[model samples]
Target: MGPDGVDKKILLNAFNMNSVGHICHGLWTHPRDQSADYARLDYWVKLAQTLERGKFDGLFLADVIGANDVYGASPDAALLQSVQVPINDPIVLISAMAYATRHLGFGVTANLTYERPYLLARRFSTLDHLTGGRIGWNIVTGYLDSAARAMGLTEQIRHDDRYDMADDYLDLVYKLWEGSWEDDAVVRDARNGRFTDPAKVHRIRHDGPFYQLDAIHLCEPSPQRTPVLYQAGGSPRGRAFAARHAECVFTNSLTVDLTRSIVADLRRRAVANGRAAEDIKIFSGVIVIVDRTEKAAQEKLREYQRYASPAAGLTHFCASIGVDLSRYGPDEPIEMEGTQAMVAALESITRYNPGRPWTVRRLLELMKLGARNTPIVGSPSQVADQLTAFVRETDVDGFNLMRAVTPESYEDFVDLVVPELQQRGAYKEDYAEGTLRDRLFAGRGGQLPSRHYGRRFRYGAGEWADEAVSRQAGRRGT
Candidate 1:
């Protein structure tokens, strides 16, 4: 509970991947683990049901187009450990899981680098329609060099440049999703045998630097024309991009002060982008190992740690921050000159602990608890108290809870921590009404509020008439 005597509810999302072993590394080898069954449809169905039973806000799926080859300058270590490679497409699993539950939302990560905006717009629209608008897109630009190479490129674009491409990409998708069709475009009039009114649907003619679409959107306006935009970019440029476009932002920070600073900066940028500061929601990555007692939780954490792969952790970090940590000495301070990913992370660490210097060894020790995000290991009430304190101190909206083991970690959270939070009124006992956007911003409405920039593009009857006329005149050189 917050100091104001009011319960501070948190938006909870289950962070998972489509691969055998995600951040937990060798936990796939665990006896009771079912992540190896990820290929089977039943695996996802069961997982989705479990999350819904716990009243989770959403199941956030992480995906990667390439292997974790950056660790040893080869894919050998990654292949041996199954660090996010051999991953199936997350989109294919959404509908199957959506079929199993009513209120659980699905946030699937898709790299916008290789995909054309036109195709992606239709794909997400179809998902939103099928899932009853419980769909969210975790927008990402390809980070791994392997991903770029697989896409027929020599190397990935510079970190900041990817965000520039994303800006254009967003513009194109927004046109297709929000501007292509009038709100009243579809009319199933049986007596007249009239379907969609052709005049109501406008063709999107875009001649952008990266993409061009001279056609109407294939799908009709979904319940949420644009799925709830979730972005997990941690760089300065990334935060700026999120501030402008994202409805929800995912981040990782070790300390509450660091999280607070990041959130403040993001909200400030949002305000600068003509969006209200409160329009964006921030969720930090966190792992909770809770039990009936603190001692039991510590025992569980120790047991889970025995399965933890430091090499796998290094591989994951290497891929994400574009740094090969193997080159640095254990005691040496990490040099962050070349990679933006390295610099961003190093800056955060330094900012968080101004007094202490971070060496390669120190960083590795930190990664023992998944990544750099804070890990809470204690009894249900103890964990809840810490979580509430973190939220109040950091000013974050909620958490993206990471799993240390397949279903066990998730099951523990659902069984222990969730009930404690519910009893304290710090977590929702039931889902809210409407779309994922509606559920997240409950009582705010089903659509992006007027404060969001996307709201400007929402087409009403003849809303774009003046702009259309102007564009037509410009084309005619008038």
Candidate 2:
């Protein structure tokens, strides 16, 4: 039960990437893991079907544009470990998965830093339409310097400055998705031979330092004109950005106190921006290893650890912090400073855990599962109790379950944990009907809510702005 004594249904998203090695670095070597077949459509299709059967909320797809090359000042370690380098475009796989499942939402991460807002808006709209409004865009301003270099930049934009650029980019896309077309724009009158009423469609004009655009949306409005907006950032500036724009905020699973603080701050920031506290659903990334009994689950974890590599996890972490961990001795205390790469991640180790004095040895030991998050290993009842307490205390809406052994890890959660949570009334036994947005918000329509900052770009508001300009011009004529 929640603070209000009501059961808060836990939401789960199968957090994954279109690659062999995702969060759990070296687990791709597991015999039962089929993550290597990520290139095949059938693999994703089957995953989607399984998630639907388990009644998962969504499949959150993570993406990185370039290699993780900071460690040892090279990509060799990352390449050898298959650490997120042999990745594919996540957006292309969505339609097939959507076709296979009726209600699984796809939260795809696209770095807005390198993608043009105009084209990116159209692509999301196309997917939202194809998926019947079950599409979401995990808005990201990339942190990798390698990604910037690949996009023809010598270095990355300063950490906060990237968010600044993203702010403008979002405004331009909002104009396209929410303002360019009206609800009645499409007439589809075959007898009268008029397909659409052009007057209802308006041209959007935006001129900002980072992005400038003046065009009507290419396609007519999709079911959710703007796909469900998702953001992940825990820094002060990032929190501000998410508060203003994001409907769902992806976060890291740290200590309960730290997670609660972060969640509270996000909700407070949302309320400050004229949105309700409940508007933003928080999903923390976690790893789970479960089976029929506690002993079996512990044995499963032990078996999986044999193939895990702490060195690969360190390599991935090095790129995230923009520091080479290899320079530090095993027992030496590590000092971290601000970097263009994930500012929040660097702070997670140093700022959040004050006076803990993390060492290379401790960091490596934490990667027992070859991932940053430690696994929650237990039987169904034990895991369910822990998850319920987490939700009750942290006020987190749900979890983004990271894969330890691809299909095996996910299948375990669905069969084991889902039933236990359902029995406790902490999880949904069946999915709620409607678009992703509708299901998530329960009776709120499949569009941005009224209080959302994006809704200001809606049809009548845009038209009013144009009319006000014309009225001023008429007075000048008089």
Candidate 3:
């Protein structure tokens, strides 16, 4: 507790992607960085053990179905820089990691646009069952035209329409997860020779514009009927979708003021949608390098910078917001009308930091280690103070710590900063009981809460269940 005497706990999530070079472009070449071994099962297992030791809330694994070819209108730069290439499936790593650590949660990114609701529902249910309720889905809609082409489409769907499709997709999945199996559907009644009651199982019937499914959920009700819903959409339409469904939201903003505003807006939207003020926990992306003293931390950062690639960073940034920064002059400002992809993302950058607009050179500088997520290098105590103050001022629930190097970055934080944070009463000392949802939500059940739109689809629920898919379609005009 600080002067206010409020025990504010910060949720720490290890932000990583299943690739050689995830965020920090050339860090894979660092002498001690073993990121090249991402293909092996042991690498992930060791990572899981380490994070669980540090009392991290979860390990968020990012994925992309297709290559990042938007840079320079070709995939040459991306492939050469190893910028998230040779990426493997994130879901496959979860089971192995879960087997390695009992308490740590897994937030796996999955694009809802590619897979059907029924298929995706069963996969998550299986993961939830296997992880013993430690699984969470980071819902993402495909943004890359490369991904769209890979799926046999001419190009990606319109940005807002992607969210609209997700709106319908989630509605159908919710019905399958919530309405298909009654709470007590499975009964081990050997005396009566009944494994499950057929009457308790209901088929989820959905018929709408995008997809059609008329089948019961393939897997039984897992520990959590719906794995913890995590979403990372920052657009207006995205916020509305997240407000209605997401349990946790991943947020990225250039400044603290911007981040605070985004958090406030999301919470307000959630409340307006009939949820509680604290219903959605916003996790701001941050990069921290710490040591016993500020000088040591700064020295470490300098050493890491030697391996950072400014070129690759710029390449990745261009692909992210859909603007070819290489085409513009070094000092050219990125305007909204110019960007053809992730318009909402680019708008946030241009809108927030008016004094210094993001130019090609500036954007490249920001991506030296990773794009836009401001890195903080300081002594353990100083870093702790900064992080605590950030959360307090911004109303964010936690920080998603992006790794600068492999296990070393995480190891350093766990050894140094975590102790200081714990002493200051800003971080938890021990793992909490129950599912990931329960731990995050204090004592709330594993399933989505009563106010969540998903809960309305409870078995044989009101008129909404019958028309949920079509209802959302009509509302969105999709």
Ranking the candidates on lDDT from highest down gives 2, 3, 1
Best by lDDT: 2
Candidate 2: where is the Cα deviation over 4 Å? 2-6, 462-478
The predicted structure with the larger lDDT, 1 or 2, is 2
RMSD of each: 2.2, 1.6, 4.0
Model 3 misplacement above 4 A: 1-7, 338-340, 463-478
Tens-place lDDT per residue, model 2, 1-478, is 5433436688899999998888898988989889899999999999999999899999999999989999998999999999897999999999999999998999999999999889999999999989999999999998888999999999988989999999899888988999989988999999999999999998888989988888999989999888999999889999999999999998894688889999999999999999999999999888999999999999999999999888899999998888888898998888867688888888888878877688889989999888889888999998887888788889899999999998998899999999988887778888888889998887599899889988888877744577668989999995
Compose the digit string of candidate 3's lDDT tens values, residues 1-478. 5642435699989999999877788888889999999999999999999999999999999888888887789999889989889899999899989988999999999999898678889999999999999999999997788898999999888888888888889888888888888888899899999999999898777887787888988778888889899998887888899999899999877778888888999999999999997889899988998888999999998898888888888777777788777788989887775543666677876865578787878877777674556688999888987888888889899988988888899999999989988887778899988999999998788778888878888775654455767778899999
Global Cα lDDT for candidate 2:
0.90
Worst 10 residues of 1 by lDDT: 340-349
Top candidate (TM-score): 2
- Of candidates 3 and 2, the better by TM-score: 2
Over 1-478, each residue of candidate 1 has an lDDT whose tens digit, in order, gives 5442434578899999988877767667767677888899998999999999999999999888888887769988888888887799999999999999999999999999988788899999999999999999999987788888999998888888888989889978887888888889999999999999999898877777777779889998899888999998877888888988999999787677778989999999999998888788889888888889999999987887777776677778777777777888888776555763434665565544676677767877876654554478999889888888878878888899888777888899999889988887888989888999998987687666776766666665233566768879999999
Evaluation by lDDT, superior candidate among 1 and 3: 3
For each candidate in turn, the TM-score is 0.95, 0.97, 0.95
